[model samples]
Target: MKKVDTNKYTKLTLSLERIRGIITELPHNGHRFVVLYDDKPDKQGYIQTILEDDTLGEQSPYLLETRVYHTEDTFSHYRKSCTKAQEIFPYFEDFYKDIPFSYENWEEVTKEFLED
Candidate 1:
């Protein structure tokens, strides 16, 4: 028998305005912003992952990129600062928001689904 991964993927849904508010303050709180794109034709929403800048390192200097995922084939981008993060907010659907995750417990919080 093949063992299947039973971990479930979860996402929070909020208004776009709320999402923008959270992104604006990420830099002040020593955090980075991530946007997860949904490729499903019927689902036009996106998922936001907030990660610590220091934990991810500084390999890429560009403000945007094409990949950012661990267990899925979704398109994602990470921004190190508020300004760079906000640049792409306007392109997001007007229906998503993200709450700040504590850096100290980020791993615990994301470990379930983030694990490959």
Candidate 2:
């Protein structure tokens, strides 16, 4: 499993706007890690695990490496966020998932399938 400097993001209080900002504020090109987790059991356990890697595309400092932890758990979370990511930012799935552990967009698509 990969690790992120949680301290880096923890220094800042997170809210919906903040999560959105991380996504919006990131630089255009770079390996990005976008994690969406369930705010249930142990808290955002699964989703956050997904976005801990900043290894996508060629390494680029200009890259906006970040993880967006949303308060969403279960298939519904995936449905909502996945849909919103598409609507919020086209090519959103493409933004992340090339990295390992992603299972590609399939993790997001068959979220319910995987859970069961």
Candidate 3:
């Protein structure tokens, strides 16, 4: 398990763990607040205890409405009980099943994704 820092955009409303994904070069493929720096996702928003939007809420029966981020291709959200930072480790570990790849740097990669 790991901890995540806070992001300025949703800093006050969400927990620090909720907002930490923007700090790393990891591919945040499935989580809403977790933005992938290179992949160019399109939409970002929050889910709550109750909502009408079917695409962005209620994946788990026990959980309330979950926040979600959507790309042109799909939707994503933080896994229940995991911080955005802790959430990344498992996904990245699976991604790098062998050794490593030359991922582009974070700031520039994110900028490049966002610009597209």
lDDT per model vs. reference: 0.38, 0.33, 0.30
- Model 3: runs farther than 4 Å from truth? 1-34, 40-78, 83-87, 93-116
After superposing candidate 2, which stretches have Cα over 4 Å from the reference?
1-13, 28-31, 42-86, 89-116
Candidate 1: worst-modelled 10 consecutive residues by lDDT:
1-10
- Candidate 1 lDDT over 43-89, as tens digits, reads 44343534334344432221322233443454333323222555546
The Cα error of candidate 1 at residue 27, in Å, is 1.3
lDDT of 3 by residue, 34-116 (tens): 32222223423332221123253333221222223345544433323322334334433422232232222211122322424
Q: What tens digits encode model 2's per-residue C-alpha lDDT throughout 11-110?
A: 2334444445555533332314444333335443333212222343122222122233344444322322231222333333333222323333432444
- Between 1 and 2, whose TM-score is larger? 1
Give lDDT: candidate 1, residue 47. Answer: 38
| Least well predicted 10-residue stretch by lDDT in candidate 3 | 101-110
Considering lDDT, which of the candidate structures 1 and 2 is the better prediction for this target?
A: 1
Which candidate number would show the highest lDDT if scored against the true structure?
1
